[model samples]
Target: MAILILLTTQLRAWSQGEPPYITLLQGDSIYVGNSIALQDTVFYDVLLKPTIEKTLSVYNIISLRINEFDTKVIPDSFQVHVKVRIYYADSANAQDSIDEKTLTVTYNKFSTYEGKAILRLRGAHWVQVKVLEVTADYATLSAVLPVVELENRMVINRDFYMDEEDDAITTISKDTTTLEDCQELKVYWTPSQVAEMYDLEWTFIDSSAINAGWYNTGGVKDPVKIFRNNASRVRISSDQYLIPLLYDGKGALYYRVRAVQEKENGEILYTVWSDLGDHRFTGHETNLNWQATTTFAEEGKRKSVVQYFDGSLRGRQTVTRDNTTKTTLVAETLYDKQGRPVIQVLPAPTLSQLIAYTPLFNVEDETKEYHKGVYDTLSGSSQYCSQTSVPFSPASGAANYYSASNPAAEEKEFQYIPESNGYAFVQT
Candidate 1:
């Protein structure tokens, strides 16, 4: 009898060819084939036959019964049982043991179907259902919906980060990284395609001052302390950042920037930092008294001295000495508060001591020849003293010359001579 039953099952499998591919429709969702996991109680099923066109559509009314719940359609004396396996760690060995439970399903009236369908599954982790028999008046159906327990799994999401090609600022070079004067240092950057603003970070590493030739001969080093206080100043797109008044021009500065975006609901997002840029610093202070001394090699024994008072050039003196003749020419200029030269002291004249005044000349001899006096012919040591008028004031004139004998004489007052276009300085 077992041999006869195996022969009959083989013949049935051969006649059926492949398993039936059915489509279950529940509202807008469609489930296909025998691998369907039941979601709603009511759905329509369509039997798809495998032909040359694979186009045969045969509708069969399927009634599924599993998980202690059934559809609204009343089955003709139908019963269902679910095979459940609960796994637990085995105390005797390293394998897991299974506990089996056989439970019968009950019919419920919560389903409303437009057409005939079968799927009465609920509360099963891993279930596979199969239908056995069906009829008209006395329909007898047999199905197995196996429920198996599975291990829990955790999922992680991977993020896509930015690359160096999307950096916002240009590379640091000699032309862009030198800080020489008291002017504000401006750092420019390219705009990011995805960012609305940017966050800036900087640090200054104290090092030796740059040489007078504007060369950063001082060695560069890594920064030990970072200035995060400036990072809070988030800037909008394409805006140039001016370094704050925090540097004293005694060292080098390092900067790195990143992109930032803000959502409509006030959520901020940040990106990774860009490459670090190094900038060398020279003197940029303004409020202190300073002096500069320079010696020239081409001009023999030439030296220039410049003095500044309250950030303004106060005095400048150039000395040129002839080492062979033991003579020196000292020309100096003194400036007022407005940076205009107030006094210009000229070099003393080196005139010959012999004079051409003839003491024996007759008092009325018209033809007697007498050379010009040495004092009258030679230029004297004089200082050109100037008084600059105040801004928008009415007076102006030429500078006054004071001889060495009357070196203490004050500047002569002058008037503003009105011209066709503007006022001219007229010495009175």
Candidate 2:
């Protein structure tokens, strides 16, 4: 019964004529002479019949794979050639063809030949493989061609926050005069194509080193630190970062971003790091003060008064001795954004006017005298003397006599002129 079964199998194989060729499609093994029908005609089984007949009339064939096989008979010494041709599904016109290949075979040694070709199928396309001619023995071949869409490319666009101050002033310099305070740093990117996550790498260097050309000369190099954001975004604060302040006179932060994507095969793909973004500290605030001496005469007495002037918060205050009397005079001035005095808070005396009623006091003896001057808004001293003007009390006998009852309190304006080591102010 076993021998009969084997003979029957051989007879069935002989009846098929051509050697068996198998193709793998979506992990399913399909052989020639068997056709798979679907709603959409994707792949079809082609049989090499004596008289070719039209098969399916549906979708296009995108990809195919044929397993390698061997010829039943071996050639003595000559070579065999095989050729493959691809064509449009609906037409007999050929799209592509592979030239014939010579096959090598020997007695008692079976030789096999195989070929494969993949083409991106459009609306309707198919492939055909055929043996052109055989000098001695017949050869079998197989192929696999998959139609797939290409992956989309990724792009990264980064933005760095340099200056978020109210003035929107971005400082970029190595000079001490240009130093400013920066507290927060932010960075974000776009076009996260096919990325499941992202990573941010940051580093910093002292501006002093850069100023001295350390980078160009291969001096100390800063180490990079990486942070996995797991998303295409990040906002770094002062606590999370050790960004240097401009007040330190030598700090700069640099950063870069990259996209990560995972594949079905457990492989990961990373996009190239984005261009480096940098922020540098440039300028800071400084405190300054100075003193000036002046002589005041009143009631036949001349007294030298030393005045102290200090600048704070875009304003200035002057403290000096009242002229003619041993009293004290304090004047506070407020400045606007344009550095012009907008308000003046002059001292009002309660006891000075009443002193004239005393037996030794005379009404004519009260004389107003201007001693020290007020500073212009945002004015400072350098190394030389700076000329500044203040609201001065008119001469003793002048029509405008500044008294305690009528203080010379009015909005005064001045312009600061830059000079050597100091600022010269002129009343405007």
Candidate 3:
């Protein structure tokens, strides 16, 4: 390591005595590779730790000057160099003894405005430096005496350590296992060096579309991109991530992973996406209900209906529509014991089955509510209301309202509120 001071011109060259001069702008006590840059000069300070293995040190001072003098002004080329003498001083009186007989002069020539001069001073102890002469083509200068102190300072190893960003070298792969007789997918990857955390992105496409050649590309095309941003991406510290397997139909999911390093300067650096993998998911046992349509012999006259059931084969909901009449009807059934409504917290019966395989209650003498209502075709306005528990128990002193199915009934309209718990209802 070496201490360097750089002086250069920022504008046109100055005639003889008006040339810019270099000075010590700041303190010399600086760590290795520390630098200070001013308008026209730059300084580099180097400090080495104390060790018994080495003794000699080198201090380099570089000065650069631009000689923009026209070619017609000076017929011959110009030369500029500095002469220095290195000698030890007596610590008791601090007296420097220089021998002119052993002094040497080094000439550095500048052919263009981009030339630089380097002055190397090597010593092992406190040395005194005296610029005996500075030979320039245009400037008449005096001697320059600069006393520089060179000392070996001790520093901790941590001062020399720097953090480096890590690259994601992990190979991402998928794992599948039978979960409640349904295949579940899990993504895992290998860990890399210096990885503070990881980012994961995934997207899916229907496998049927690929098989039908609907996509022009030979591989997965224009997938439904999900988790593309930092907020949505699975930012996890662990190497493995698991997401709920929602099987709408047969589909293949593609995913990638990358490592991230957060710097102390509040800047984040991320590695490139390195690992690409895919998982093919199929129909699960949870998908048990489906839809079908039927048509009549008359034109523009048809009926379509879809029926949903619970895991115990109990009817849950039925939606029916008539094309000729342009009418729709929905009916739902709920189960509870002793007039107390049963709450189905889980949306899918298979999910509820996974949590508790056995049924909790078997209602023998259960009370039910059949709500039916209708309104004019012009009355389509409705307002939202807060959700509260419906006191189905007869002891609550609430009247039990019931209505039977009327096939040819037409007068009032009904609006089903999905947010209602325990039982779905339609209000007039």
The window of 10 residues in a row where model 1 has the poorest summed lDDT is 1-10
Name the 10 consecutive residues with the lowest summed lDDT in model 3.
153-162
Listed per model in order, the count of residue pairs whose N, CA or C atoms clash below 3 Å is 0, 16, 4
Output the lDDT of residue 42, model 2: 19
Each prediction's RMSD to truth: 35.6, 34.5, 27.6
* Decreasing TM-score order of the candidates: 3, 1, 2
How do the residues 1-428 of candidate 1 rate in per-residue lDDT, one tens digit apiece? 00000001011111111123333322112112212322111111222111112211111112322322333345524333333332221112232323333333333345532121222221222222222222221232312222111111111111112233453444422234323321225576665534546666565555542223232323433222334332223344544554532344477666667777554466677776666666666543334444534343321222333333433435444333332243333444444434566444343212111111112121112342212221012334452233322211111111111121223233343123212111111112
What would the TM-scores of all predictions be? 0.26, 0.20, 0.32
Residue 367 in model 3: lDDT? 35
- Shift in Å, residue 170, candidate 1: 9.2
Model 3 alpha-carbon drift over 4 Å, by segment: 1-166, 178-183, 212-232, 284-428
Q: Per-residue alpha-carbon lDDT of model 3 for 72-188, expressed as tens digits?
A: 233233434444443432213243534421111222344334343333322212333444444444432221111111122111111111133234554788777534432235677
Question: Residue 423 in candidate 1 has what lDDT?
Answer: 15
Model 2 lowest lDDT segment of ten: 1-10
